[model samples]
Target: MHYCKEMLLIADEMRHFEGFSGALAVSNIEYMGTPNLREKQLSEFLIYSNEKEIVEQQQILFNTLWEKAIPAKQRIKEIELGIKREFAETIRDPTEIRKLFSKLLESAEKDILSISTPNTIKRIEKLGIINQIIKAANLGIKVRLLIDSHTFNEKINDKYGGELAQIKYHKLIKSLQSFVISMIVDESLLLVIDIKDESQENFEDSIGLATFTNIRSTLDIYLSLFEKGWHQSE
Candidate 1:
């Protein structure tokens, strides 16, 4: 469909032309310059064809576009307010996963819930994600970290144990076993990363498949798992 501002302006101007019809034409306007002189101005013109087949095709195109067109008011409102779209995606790149993880932590509003193995948490700490967690906790956002109790050690404690203690909203729990690194932010977004090879020390080398989503049902399931793990840790 032809949806150009120029076309609409041409259509409006065509109404003022003399002997207007479905076909296109060029017109001129003459004005009295003085007592005996006259002036003529060329009006803007649009080229067109009156072929029956072409006209029918144009009509069908316009009808299709008109049927699919949304109201301008609704479109304006969507632009004025932010668009809230829900999506779920599988991210395989480790660098991208870390970037998204840090972004979500920084954007957390009310709370942040997480479950990870000691190695995974250590990898995340090397990526500087723990700084964001600490920042969130300092801002009064509830921060919960659930780690595998079997792997908890002095190294992990020495790193974050003392720092986390000063934050009132930050809490850490040691659970039995946690296979994947999962996090839920503000109960609206979920990011899960699989531990492919725990032997690898680098965050990128040790991670496997990763999934991110804002689906409510998926978030609820993960939230339930985290709460159950929290209780077990306590």
Candidate 2:
């Protein structure tokens, strides 16, 4: 009962945090699923105020997760004692996290939406995942993607490797990033996996992800991180 309650609280936190402009993939023109609270305008807990902080912030956060929260020994003790720990502190196994992520990708059978603010790095991030989504879509599933606020090749500059770094995804409906926020709905689930490595070779690098069987039960921290990243990029 506690676990289920915590899950629902997380989902609500995620939904109310990000100010997605409008329904880009699955909502009506007027109702954006992420809400309309801008970061600058709204007073909320901020993990990182800039996109450049992703690496350092995430690194430190993950590395000290156990220390910051209940220690692994404590977690195991609680579990052994039959106490309900909503999140198991010990990395006793990676299997649980991996399985959840797999299910997230697997759940696209109904509706899957990938929304990102257009930029060389983040756009490239979406490109790496889109093909998989498309393949999933072709299997009689519905898959839609949106990249917002992308301007021109000149914006990226050749110094950063030009189009080589900029154009990662083969296809997407490029437009104002703000207008694409609301399109995400009908999504019983959402996956916001940050590929930190940024190398085409080891695309398997996963920075973080929000995995859930029901979007209504996913943690809001995931969307909060997304909004944090999205705002920093802009």
**The candidate that achieves the highest lDDT relative to the unseen native structure:** 1
What is the C-alpha RMSD, rounded to one decimal, of candidate 2? 21.0
Q: Kindly list the per-residue Cα lDDT of model 1 for residues 122-205, writing each as its tens digit.
A: 677787877777888888899887775444454455667766753332224544365688889999999999988887889889
lDDT per model vs. reference? 0.68, 0.39
Provide the lDDT at 36 for model 2. 40
Task: State the weakest 10-residue window (summed lDDT) of model 1.
Answer: 29-38
TM-score of 1: 0.60
lDDT of 2 by residue, 1-234 (tens): 344345555563212111224221121122112324353375343332234444455445434542445444455456569975443122223345444444555655565545544442344334343344445555656544444434223333332343233222223332323312222223544434433333333323433333333334343443443445445545
Error of 2 at 78 (Å): 24
Worst 10 residues of 2 by lDDT: 23-32
Task: State model 2's lDDT.
Answer: 0.39
Candidate 2 error regions (>4 Å): 1-102, 116-132, 148-186, 206-234
Residue 144 CA displacement from its true place in model 1, Å:
0.7
Each candidate's number of clashing pairs is: 0, 12
